[model samples]
Target: MKPSKHTKNQENSRRNFIKHAAVAAAGFMIVPRHVLGGKGYLAPSDRLQVAGIGVGGKGQSDIASFAKTGKADIAFLCDVDDRRAANSIRNFPRAKYYKDYREMLDKEHRHIDAVSVSTPDHNHAVQTMAAMQLGKHVYVQKPLTHDIYEARKLTEAAQRYKVVTQMGNQGASGDGVRQLQEWLDDGQIGKVETVYCWTDRPLWPQGISWPEPAAQIPKELDWNLWLGTARDLRYVEKLVPFNWRGWWEFGTGALGDMGCHLVEPPFRILDLQYPKDVQCSVGSVYVDEFKRGYFPESCPPSSHVVMTYAKTKKTKGDLTLHWMDGGIKPERPAELEANERFGDNGVLFIGTRGKMICDVYGSNPRLLPTSRTAQARTKKTIERVPGGAEGHYGQWVEGCLAGYGKMKMSSPFEIAGPLTETLLIANLAIRGFDIREARADGKGYSYPGRDLKMIWDSQNIRVTNFEAANQYIKREYRQGWTLGV
Candidate 1:
C-alpha cells in the first residue's frame, strides 16, 4: 500500500472529485475547482427570475424580501385592489402591473422563472396552477388553495412540472419549528395520541355576528374583481379589504386562516395523514335570516372541531386532532395543571411517554414532565433544518437564489396541498350543515351526521352532491375575470 505515493494521491483525488460532483448535482458548486481551499458553495449562473402576483397586504411584505436579493427580479405585480397594491407596484418599477394575473402570465411567461402567489384563499389554486402549467416555479401562501379539489390539483401540477416551489408558511422554516420536529422524531413525545391547536384570529375581524342582506359595495374596492372566481354576489363594505376571513364564500374561517400555522407543526412532526372522522360545532351567532346580520362577512362567533386521524400503515396508530377558535381551549392535559392555558392560541402534543408544547406557528417549544426529566449534563447538539430564514418572504428569496432547487422548502406543495384540503372541508361542512354528514373517504372526505354522504372524486373535482353542495365547492367567476387552474 505504501509502495507508491502517486497511487495514494490518485485515490484521494478520485474521492474528492466524487464529493464535489455530488454537491454540483444537488444544485451547488464548490468554490475553487481545485477543491482544496473553497470558502463557500455558489449557485449556478442561471439566477432565477420571479414575479409577484397579488401584492397587497401580506403580499407587500412578502414580495420585498424576495426582491431585495439580486438572485431574482420582481418582474410583475398583479392585484385586483389598486389602492392596496399601489405601493408594491411603485416599489418594483421594473415590474409590469396588471389587475388580472391570468393576463400577466400569458404576456410574461417567457421572462418569468417563478411566481410569488399571495392571493385570498379562494383564488390560490387557480392562480398557482395557471403559473405552474406555464412551467414556472411558485411560492404560494399558506392554506394553498380554497377547496380540496384545488389543493389536490396543485400537488399534482407541481409534481408534473418538476419546478422549484415553496409554500408561504414561513413559520415552518423557523429554528423553533425544526426543534419541534426533532423532538417528535426523537420520540420526546411518545406516540402523539392527541393534539390541540388554537388561534386568536379574526383579530383583523373574526367572529362577526352573521350579516344582514347584501349591502352595497364600497367605491374604493373593485367588488366584481374582488369576487373573482367566487359566486356572483353584491359587494358589501364589511367583506372587502380585510374582513373576508370569516365568510364561507371567500374565506376558510379561522381554521383556513390559521390552521396552516397552528396545526402544521403536528402534521410535520407527527407525519399526520387525512383524518378518518371529522365533526364540527358552531356557536349560535346568527343574526340574519340567511345566516347572513353584522356588516362584515366572517365566520360564526365561535367554533370547535374534532378530527380523528387513523395512523397510516407505517405509523403507530390512531391519533386525534382538535382545533378551537375564538379563545377556546380543550380540556387541559392533567400534567400541566398549573401551566397557563394557551391564551390566544397554541398547540399541545400528548404522546405516550411525554408531551411537548409549541407556541402557535412553533415559536417557543418546551418539554412537558419537566420535573420527571433530567437535564443533560453535556450540551446536546440540536439538528437545524435549512428552511429557517428570517421571515417567510426572506426564506423564499433565498430558495429562489438556491439554484438547482437546493433550498429546503418549509411548505412545499406536496405537504401543504393535503393540509389545505382538510381545512377546506371544514368550510364545506359549515355551508352544508343542514344537508348530510360527509365522511372521510378515499376520493375525498365527507360531512358526517347527514342523511346522504357527498362522494367527492377529488381527482376529477366532481361531487356526488353536485345537486346539493357542488356549488359551494367551485364558485362562478365574474365577467371579464376568469382564472383556470
Candidate 2:
C-alpha cells in the first residue's frame, strides 16, 4: 500500500531541512563540543563525527579502529585511489565518499567534528592543518609530516588552534611504554644514558633509481590528487598503495615509517628533545663489487644514525641515541642469552647502573641479565590507558569529545612533534651522507658530507655546522599546496 499523505509530508520536510542545513553550514565552520556544551555538561557518551582522508591501507584500518570504540561515526571518506578505498567504502556503506579532501572538508565541515589523516607523509601537514583550521580535531599518522619544518609548524598550530590532536603512534598509548615508564621511575634500570632503536623495515625496495619508462597511472587512481604537496611526476609502478616509503619525495624511509613507534618511548622516558648533534653512515646500494649505486632520491638500503641530546632534568649528563634501520641490529646485550630472540624491532636503553630492553612500542620491557627483571622495580606513576595501546583510538575520540586540553594524550603533537623532529634530524644526517660533490680529478664524486656531524640549532630549526644540510629542514612545497593557516 502507498504511504499516507501525512507520512509523505513528514519525509519531504525532513529532506528539505537537511538540504537547508547544508547550505547554511557552508558559510561557517563547525563549532566544537566545548563551545556547545560549555563547562561541566559534556557527557561521556557523546559521539564524534569523523571524516577520513586517504581511506585505504592504514587509513582504512584507522577508521575501523575508531568505529570499534563505538563512540565514533565514520561520516565521510576521501581518497584518490578508488581501489584502495574500496574496503572502507564497503565497510562504511552509509558514509559519503569523495575523491578530493578539500571538497569533502568544505562540503561536510559542519557534519564532521574530527579528521583522520592517513595519507602519504608528504601530504600529512597540509591535510591535517586544513582540518585543524576548521576547528576539527585531528589524528594524523606517525612521523607526523614529511619535513622537519612541517612537524614544527604542526606542533605550534596545535597550540594556536587549541584543538585536540593525537599522532598515529598507537604505541604511545600502549601498556608497554607505561610499564617501562613505571620501571624507570622505580629505578629498575637506573639512569638511562643511551638508547638504541632498530627496525627491519623498508621491507619494500629502497636505494634504487626511480624506475624508468613511466608506467601508466592506474585507471582507479587520480594521479594529480595523489601527488598532493609533492611535485607532480609521471606515475611509476609499485609507488602507489605502498612502496612510496623509500622515496624522499613521498615516504620518509625507515625513520618516518617506524621512528615514532620505536623512538617515542625514549623521548618520553628520557625527557629528550631536539638533538644537539647528529651523524650517520649508510649501507651503499650495489650492483656489483666494483661500483656502488647512487640514488639520491631513494633512502639507503640501511643506515646507522647517531644523535646526541643535551641533559634534561631526567638525565645526569648528555644522552645519546642510536637508530639503525634496514635490518641493522645492535650488538646483543651480554645479559640476554645467545639463543634468545632480539625481536625484529627493538629498543635497548643503557642506564648508568644497568640496561633495559623492549620490543616495539616499548612492549615486553625487561631489565638486563634477564634475572634482574624479576627483581623489584619502580611503582607505577603514569596511569595506564584504559585499553592500553589499542586504546589509542578511543583516547583521541574521547579527547575530542572533551575539547582541547581537557583530556590528556600520550603523543600529542607537542610531544610527537619534538620526537618526530628528532627523527627527521637523524634523517638529515642520513640524507647528508648521500650528498655528493665532484672530485677535482673527475674520477667520480666525493661526499664532503660523509663523516661530518651536523650541529643543530633547534631554536632556529637549522643545522649550524652543515650549511648544506640546513636546506632540508624546510623543503619547498609544490606550487599548489601550502601548509594551511
Error of 2 at 476 (Å): 1.7
Top candidate on lDDT is: 2
For model 2, state the Cα shift of residue 334 in Å: 0.5
For candidate 2, the clash count comes to 2
Instruction: State the lDDT at 465 in candidate 2.
Output: 72
Candidate models: Cα lDDT each: 0.70, 0.89
TM-score for each prediction? 0.77, 0.90
What digit string (tens of lDDT, one per residue) describes model 2 on residues 386-437?
Answer: 9998899999998998899899998899998999899899999998888888
C-alpha root-mean-square deviation, candidate 2: 9.5
Off by over 4 Å in 2: 1-45
Residue 40 C-alpha lDDT in model 1? 47
When superposed on Cα atoms, how far off is each prediction in RMSD? Answer: 10.5, 9.5
lDDT of 1 by residue, 1-485 (tens): 46588888999999999998888877554444435435443343345677787798888877787866545577788888888888997888877888878788889899888898888887787788888889888998878877776777788888888777778877777776667666666666666777888876656555554456778665556666667777776665556667777776677878888888888888777777566545566655556677533332456666677776768432357887788887787776667658655447788888777877877778877677544334413233454544454555665566655642577667788888877876766555555543443355655344343433344454455454445655566666556444454
